[model samples]
Target: MPRERELILGGQRSGKSRRAEQRAADWLALDPAHRAVLIATATAHDEEMRERIARHRADRAQRVPGLVTVEEAVRLGPALARHSEPGTLVLIDCLTLWLTNLLMPAESGSASPALAETAHAGLLHALHGARGPVLLVSNEIGLGVIPMGREARAFVDALGRLNQAVAGACDRVTLMAAGLPLRLKEPG
Candidate 1:
């Protein structure tokens, strides 16, 4: 794989995470010395979510046995910095979940707006300074009608802005629909 930063955006079940995993798997297949690390940003807040995470883990392991997994719900900047290396591919499985962990914490009084901003900035900086290739997966939830609740609206807006920022930072951006990828930005 080329040394580039790529972002994948899609709706739920639109195959964003699957595309990122495929890229990581392809990168790992290139050489024995190559390494791939998946930064999982999902946090289990309920039983169903916990089970979903477990299922994803099992599926990913079967798909990419060589890809190492690192569970990091918050502090993604630090996680990316620590794992990014010259011969390594760093894949973030989803950015919206990371944003949720920031803006809408399951436990109240854990994160503030300023904290979220700082984390967001830190992630951008880490991306700019990464020594290896990176693939980021994120949701594109703004394609439908506006949300009803205030919190839902806020989350939607936040994710939209976050996606724009990451897309600008990446060398390539792709939108997935029905398991097919449409290239939005090509690396120059």
Candidate 2:
């Protein structure tokens, strides 16, 4: 059977993550050797972020026992290549954060478009060649009002483009709202 590639997008608290996890569980239950791996992109740079990460970890433990997690903040292509296999299910929770990490000025003090472009290209390439099922989660932030700040606007623009590219590559695309999934695209 051909592998499935799905893109899940939603607003805050829309349950996109939960839906992805459930799908992963279902995929793993199909075969004894099927493995589920989470590719986490968020970094705990602040107390709130740390707490959020902890909560996600706890929730995963309670919900998906067989799921393994791999933290790859920037180098996503290599990570995807390393984990994806015929009987494996790879879930990438939140791409918006990864874009933020790329666009936001780091300790070195400036954002690098060249780096972001490279990562984006790498991700698309990896997704196209994935041997197993892949699920990607990202926020639908473009639904809100336009931001007043330049950086915020830039982020929204970048995220919008990224989402579009991924959605085009995916065989299925779902939009979550109020914990309900509305299918946007499905394989014909």
Candidate 3:
């Protein structure tokens, strides 16, 4: 097998992020030289968010000893391209936050579509062109009822489409629930 492109999808508190981290650690174990890049896509805008981000970072550090963590909430493609080496194992915590950053209040009026498209294009380009193994984490929100507001609806729709595109390109797809992983696709 060349390098694995993995997508781990699940709902909130479904343990998807934990699975992604574990997978990255496993991938890095085979080759210690393979750097573990944690592309954290969250910015702590409030106290709760700050605490959540901190706990996650701490947990990741403990889980993957000596793993290098890079915090690039935005500018994902360029960040990955610049920081990654040939054998790097890149782990993106969640695509949902990245989408939020691109599609949030600043993009309120009619400017959202173009901005979101550009961001999505950049993300897709990165996923396809990344140098080494990549494990992307995202929420599976489409399983629930449609969101009430336009922003929420758009977010869910965009995430669903993005997940589909990534999963199609990926070599492996895993869904997590209650911290257990259900492997959907694996290399034959």
Estimate TM-scores for all models: 0.97, 0.97, 0.91
Each prediction's whole-model lDDT (CA): 0.93, 0.91, 0.80
lDDT of 2 by residue, 106-163 (tens): 5556888789889999999999999999999999999889999998898899999999
> All predictions: root-mean-square deviation over Cα?
1.1, 1.1, 2.0
Q: How many Å off is the CA of 155 in candidate 3?
A: 1.4
**After superposition, candidate 2 runs with Cα above 4 Å error:** none
> What C-alpha lDDT, on a 0 to 100 scale, does residue 145 get in candidate 2?
96
Off by over 4 Å in 3: 105-111
Candidate 2 TM-score versus the reference: 0.97
Q: Model 1, residue 108: what's the lDDT?
A: 87
Ranking by lDDT: 1, 2, 3
Off by over 4 Å in 1: 109-111
Give the per-residue lDDT of model 1 (tens digit) for 80-129: 99999899999998899999999889878464668888999999999999
By lDDT, is 1 or 3 better? 1
> Model 2's lDDT to the true fold?
0.91
